[model samples]
Target: MVDPRRAFALRDAFAQQVTRRLKVPAVEQRAYADRLQAALDGQTLGGLSGEYVVLVDRNANVQALFIYFRATPSDTWQMIGASPVSTGRPGEYDHFITPLGVFEHTPANMDFRSEGTQNDNHIRGYGQRDMRIFDFGWAQGQRGWGKGGISEMRLQMHATDPDWLEPVLGIRHSKGCVRIPASLNTFLDHYGILDAEYAALAESGKSLWVLKSNRQMTPWAGRYIVVVDSQRESRPAWAPAPGGKALAKVPAGASSAD
Candidate 1:
């Protein structure tokens, strides 16, 4: 029951916003025209479709996709990576509610190293350090939930389960990982076009391929804001790097370890 036209328009607006935030070249703007055409063709968006980046809003509930294709001119808006995830617990237990920004897949976090089955979200990549979070403590409201740590060992996309979809419907869920659902997890892990943030920028050459791609609780006037483009070698952007837990060593009456 949503307006797809408005959704596309909003996608363009926010894509510009995020592109400005990153401060890239103005010439890259043309890249969006092609992306626009592809979106109309039916690129649907769920993974690193072709060559692009994805943006999510932490300050707001918005998710957008920008297709950055360079190698071979393809008219398809591929879904890359995304943020604004509903991680951990919603309220009290959800310590790591991540923010909105550009994060990439690093070598250490690549989930393909494991010689086992990882049909879940942990197959994307891992974090630099254990990802600790600070999110709302309840299911619907926003209050500090103290802090918690998620090992840098599980970088996730979304969920691959239908039953596990509701919690992520603009609420909060997951255990400190970028999430999706069975509906779109495979596409995301399969494309892996956003192998690195730099590649993302190179894909677009400088513009954003915007689109309103999430089917969840969106409070934005339009649909959502997504930034699909590439970038140059920067600081790998800013990702949340959590520290060690600050819990007490032991109780006053408890005995010490050997």
Candidate 2:
């Protein structure tokens, strides 16, 4: 387990590194942490002592990723940092809704760096060259295309095209994977935030070329990314939509936990 003092220190350090901060309140942060714990418990992934975990709310109104850490299985999860992200956006052919639940990051599905090549549409689907792609292997997702049905899709989290895609990160717009900011990708990669398995392999003399040579890894390296949908009816002030405005209005009787 991580020392409590050290965990707090790491939290502060991570906060400073985030380029685009999602200013969530303490109560909301705790609520997201509660959801993370629930997902872990549902998947029987408890006992992850002193580990950091990435939590993403796939709710369209709140396309945000939260970094959380806990010193022990029974300890309250504390927020490290948060940033805007783009999850799966349905309605388009070949698009799949981002799956909900806990996904473990392991060496079984090795990660790779993006080639930074633009597609036919001149869009860099995987951001700049050398950006690490956090692969979670194949996952069954609900297809967004015609005659929609469950199908196996490759799950990955990486930086999106900086010019076009990155600016629209707060909204859902991906082919099933999670798209984050390039700065956040570098932060996660440089700190080994979710590289627990890779670190373990490297410690045993296994060379992982994907890892950055100058990475300052944390002892609380995490392996899990828990995704949940808050099902908010409207956008919250803290989580603004694309143009920095809460465009969606909250209807009467809607929950305030947007």
Candidate 3:
């Protein structure tokens, strides 16, 4: 059901809008694609032929997210764009390490928008106002604090505070949710990159207030967010760590969703 022409156009738009890019080699792209297919199979979810899927490496050494598009279930996934992100950082109380698996973004969990309000520490927990929070409902995650056991944590992909935390996005800083750049947030929202269900509803004549009226939605809107940990011992040169003293000053428990 995906229009090939529109899918290509969306990829082009991704390149223009997403500023931070990760140059993943063709081989690595294939590997991630393999992983994505495996996760989907494990979860018993159908392969979304001609749809776009988001992949994230939650490894401590490499915190990056990728957008991939496939023309068919059997086709190779082409990398559309990549960006730096912050995954769960466990070491403090109430922090959970981001779970690894294929998570589906659906209306069952109900996505929400950030008010962009600052907490007492003067940090915008969910980035600026109107930022879309891609909710995946409660997921079992490894506890980063306490005795380090497993617990249920709400898994979400959203933008972090632009001024204070967005700069250090490459490193782990969130409680359990995935923190992304405001630009990437806008890119995903405006394109309905992961809004497959929302688009479907709209097509059925259901008006979703969350979807922007001026949006240029792709025909191949996807619903899966595949998270994997490469378990790399060191950071690769292509995925450089964030520099500056600001990395050290990232406040503990900065995420508001915890």
- Return the TM-score for each candidate structure: 0.35, 0.91, 0.93
| Native-to-model Cα distance after best TM-score fit, residue 67 in candidate 1, in Å | 5.6
Candidate achieving higher TM-score, 1 or 2: 2
> How well is each residue in 101-129 modelled by candidate 2, as lDDT tens digits?
88989999999999998776667788899
Candidate models: Cα lDDT each: 0.30, 0.83, 0.84
Indicate the TM-score of model 2. Answer: 0.91
Show pairs that collide, candidate 2. Answer: none
Off by over 4 Å in 2: 1-4, 244-258
2 versus 3: better TM-score goes to: 3
Ranking by lDDT: 3, 2, 1
C-alpha root-mean-square deviation, each candidate: 17.2, 6.3, 1.9
In candidate 3, where is summed lDDT lowest over 10 consecutive residues? 249-258
The candidate scoring highest on TM-score is 3
Q: Which candidate, 1 or 3, has the higher TM-score? A: 3
How do these models rank on TM-score, best leading?
3, 2, 1
Expressed as tens digits, the lDDT of each residue in 47-103 for candidate 1 is 332233444323212222233332223434322222223333334443344432234
